[model samples]
Target: MNTRDWNETLRSLNVGLPDDVERLKAAGYYEEAIARIDAYLAEDWTKTQNSPYSQGLCPHMDVQPENPTPHGVDVLRDAMIAQREIMRRIPAEYTWSKADAIAEMQRRVKDFTPEEFEMLDRENRMDWRFVEGEKRYQNRFASTLIATHADLARRQIDPPAQPDSEKERCRRLHEKMAEQGSASARITLKASVGMSDEAFAAALAKAKAEGRDAVHVRAWLPLPAACLSQSDIELEEFTEEPTVIAPENAPQRTVCWEADLTENRSFGVQYSYRNTAVYTDPFDTPSAPEQPDFDTEEQPSHIVFTPYIKALAAQLTAGITDPMEKAKRIYDYVTLNVRYHYQPSYFIHESLPEHCARDRRGDCGIMSVTFITLCRAAGIPARWQSGLYVTPDEVGCHDWAMFYVAPKGWLYADCSFGASMARRGDETLRQHYFGNLDPDRMVANSVFAAPFTPPMLGFRADPCDNQTGEVEADGVGLYGDETVSSKELVQYIEE
Candidate 1:
């Protein structure tokens, strides 16, 4: 299946599980739910006419081409994903039982009591869910609770110490940029140029299926792309020659390779890029008479302007007409309101922005998407940009937003960083993120939910963003559980 068709099919399918399947799974009858899904698909497979399941046939199931019923296939796929989610992701993430949570909390908090745990649970500060009629707490619940609850954070026996060296570096960088001039005098200032070299590796774990020793494996790993703040990208080295390297301008850029695997084989690449920090104060610049409509419309499946989104946007931007102010309002709403929490995977989410807004919990990408959606709904042009937060100390996937104001053009918004600053009680730096970004970024993608140049025939592990990497074996996609990836900072030089 081509990229466009796959995306359309994903958008067309309903997000929620089938009623009977959901009921069975909720009741802990997982096997029964799987059986029911298989039965439904088998029935649909035999249908010759007058079947709703056969109406929209997608020939990309990665299964038998003769059985190309997307409705049933998608239902089965969703069911399997749910099964993996509950059995693998949820269990692995939420590893604490009631007793375990209590023990861990008491160890961390000198005078911790069961009553405090109950209170935290009541306040919904501890992330937990019922699994098989028993409550399971998230593995990071204690740390998260302490981080978010100020009083708890103060009372801890040994409070977790956060590293501030990076923050100070960013503050100094912003200060240097701010010294240039006011936004009215200089609409955009790019300073603190830095060059970085990084190496990344990805490999598929040996498949568990019988007699699959020689499976044909394919992989796609991200590579830096040129953007306003990022440039001078060079693919320096590779462990093995890649089959294809995406165009420099591809929105979701990647280097692709294929190999027949007799044993576990790692594919690696080394790349260098130069990133420049950007700063702009929208408050200092007057709004243009006419702002461009680019990126002001909805992007479906994630950035759609549903009724709830429209209502929320209207409420947030009520009586506010300035485009830059509207964007700032949206950014402030997300950063101040939403709590950061680790997510399972983007493929599992039906609408990321709506999920973040409704749940009030999301990671960096979710917050960015929510901010982008609200900005667009408020008649402001906003878009997605993400890759890695490549610092000398560490390398990890990160995402942020960009909004276009007429005179200032595209200003950056790192809602996650702003929220972090809020948690740390640093209003100065929190506000800085609304219109500025540091030089410690490697941008590989400028568009959200974009397809690859040579698209994968099977489903992608993350359909929304390609951060780490993706792999497929013998035409079947592999989830994160079936793969391992690593990113290493090779070198960094301040210019």
Candidate 2:
């Protein structure tokens, strides 16, 4: 629905719905009910502002939030998701006119190199134009953010990404899997953090004297979500017995332990799981799986359909028919065209895909959103899955896309990973991501904007999704406030 419809419906909501249908007699006054919602908790917040789901640029809106008791006000939350989506697609008004664009070059592009100007000209391609103040204006092209802005110069740099050898190996593995159905063994690995080696040794020595391994430490180890690619889930050992173990499929999978410092020398956990790669050739697939959520668009946020997105989709898939092929075209456009760069926090922007399209350079999450948005626009079912990218070397937050094609199941598209190979001119690796993904993934959050098992209070640090687990002590969230966290790949076992 359009933003206007959302606003009108929001303005005209029958806010008087009683908690129980039988209680309607006590809540018949619609105006008073709306006033109560608006003035809820003595705050005169607007409907968009009346949410705790998300903060900054997104609506904390769910059609039905998981409340133990049914609140009569949830109908309003559902409508607000639509309204918030409308707000996201609001055009980039007053960004820049032709004159302003030229002035921006003069100001930001030190020495105004002819080469840079030409690059900017190419990026513009007249994609961004909106009427502003009796004339049309153009937003500046993304070229201004060239690498290494120092000493009044912007030097270009090769795209930074996963190591070349590891990336190529992953692609080759997928190719082998696709051709021969050879499978990668699920790895049994260990993860841990926040303990000194010296302290650990001292505790371990004491535990050994007592014929034990526990040295006493507190640790939170990531627990993997149950996935077709992953199995044999186990948390073999810990410094202390786990006091908090998140559900197997929890949004941010974690198992926490607060063992006495003597119970275990190091705060750590050992677990093992296998990972199998998926490979598909789009043309070989004739249909999509009957998954419930993949068939629909994500809510009134980054993935929302708007006039701008709709037009862009039409332009991108002008003659595409086969769903798999259409999805491929979108993937090609992104991996082939978009530059990979670290982007600022996503919450600062109105829409992620729109931002990526306009700017042309963003990290994995941006590319994932862009791929998902365009694929959905082209009538393909695509969704998001992201978490830690655990290799033998490093573990860091990452995101990727899943487009469904029948017989092939859900195909993985790692545009960022593909873009990395494209930068190195590796055609095989670049194209592999369209229908395959390396098994080096910990799928923590399966869908974007999924709720936590136990809901959090206040705006979560990463409101849209959980990357690492979220933690709170004494009922106060620790993210973006007092606590910082990281995960390391202490071990990687490959068969």
Candidate 3:
């Protein structure tokens, strides 16, 4: 085995070594550190199993491995087994306790009907578990299942009245925006796009408003990148005058506002931009690899080049010479291999690429980051861009990647969107996403980890993508304090 492999394997196995070796590591002398570790293992090989080190990673002598580690045999075995589980999705046993059930029985019996309890037990299992010495725990997704699904949300907890449908809430917010008469609401769209916008607003306003969650509506709704794809910019209206409007070109542009937030108030902005669909031919040779900006480098937390990423990139790009083609291979692999699903929020992910590789399932952001890490490992420069997927119908946050190719400049790839198309066997749409994107999108973030203009008050629900604007009141921000900002379409002109 090469010295690098030994060092990486040892590090992965969490083997302990001496201070000088640590100094070598501190100096980034991985090869030298591995060599020293190897020599130590060799000298102490026969005696380590009999010593106190036997309890830990006591390296046995006369055992040679391509991946060498001094960890005890049993320790290494257990570590490998746990690593195997952690490195991939496994059916882990959820331990619920009688104590936990007893504690919640009164509430469960009071809160659920017999049929409702059976329905909850079906596929959408409530996320409840007991930890040793701790109270039974449940998250919002778990606790709100009844309210979110069973229609008891309004009755269960006396929430302020909210628009029942997303469409209605959005329309109400737009009405409030238009009511405020902000400077932003000046530009209007063409007949088609305008009609879409108007219809959306009216429909949202007219929907069957149901279980309400719009508590004290404090929000900063994202605005389009004006002087770009969208045109005829206007600030339709507002609930209250915003503290600020982040610059037209702000990485995460927003109509920042704080309001007294009377019940049912929706604060929003209105703007229209032309959709300019961008495309590139992957068969075309790409520009040679160029040095990436510091922001696009190997961020240890999310995009670090671990051994698995390196190996995967190598396997995927083998025999590919062209950077563009190599990038395409990685993109294709990601879209094809990583089935898209709603990930458990962005904060829980440590190394997104590794998580993607292990779990084999994640949302668009997961697919984007995995593609970024692999392309970077394969020596292709790629970065992140994300925002809202604006349409007359649905508006939600989305993420995608951009890889630089000479002649073509930077091109887009939407693996999640593409994967959805692939599932339909829509070759045209699927391939289109590999090298193009619909103009019907808004970019709020040009780079991941891009800082907010005034900086957020505290932990953002989504620290990566900033399509849904943030909120703060009194002092620090409320993580999920109020309604998420939304959009409406008055018109959409194909031309």
**Residue 159 CA error for candidate 1 (Å)?**
6.5
Per-residue lDDT over 4-96 for candidate 3, one digit per residue giving the tens place of the 0 to 100 score: 111112123332335765566445344455566555544544345454455675566475333244444544433232223222211122233
List TM-scores for all candidates, in order.
Answer: 0.81, 0.60, 0.57
Better-scoring candidate (TM-score), 1 or 2: 1
* Best of the two (2, 3) by TM-score: 2
Order of candidate numbers by lDDT, starting with the best? 1, 2, 3
Best by lDDT: 1
**What is the TM-score (0 to 1) of candidate 3?**
0.57
With candidate 1 superimposed using the best TM-score fit, by how many Å does residue 411's alpha carbon deviate from the native?
1.5
Worst-scoring 10-residue span by lDDT in model 3 = 1-10
Q: What local lDDT does model 2 show for residue 68?
A: 39
Per-residue lDDT for 43-115 in model 1, tens only? Answer: 5444554444467664555544454564456644654544434343444555689988998989988788999
lDDT at 237, model 2:
70
* Clash totals in order: 0, 21, 36
Measured with C-alpha atoms, the lDDT of residue 469 in candidate 2 is 47
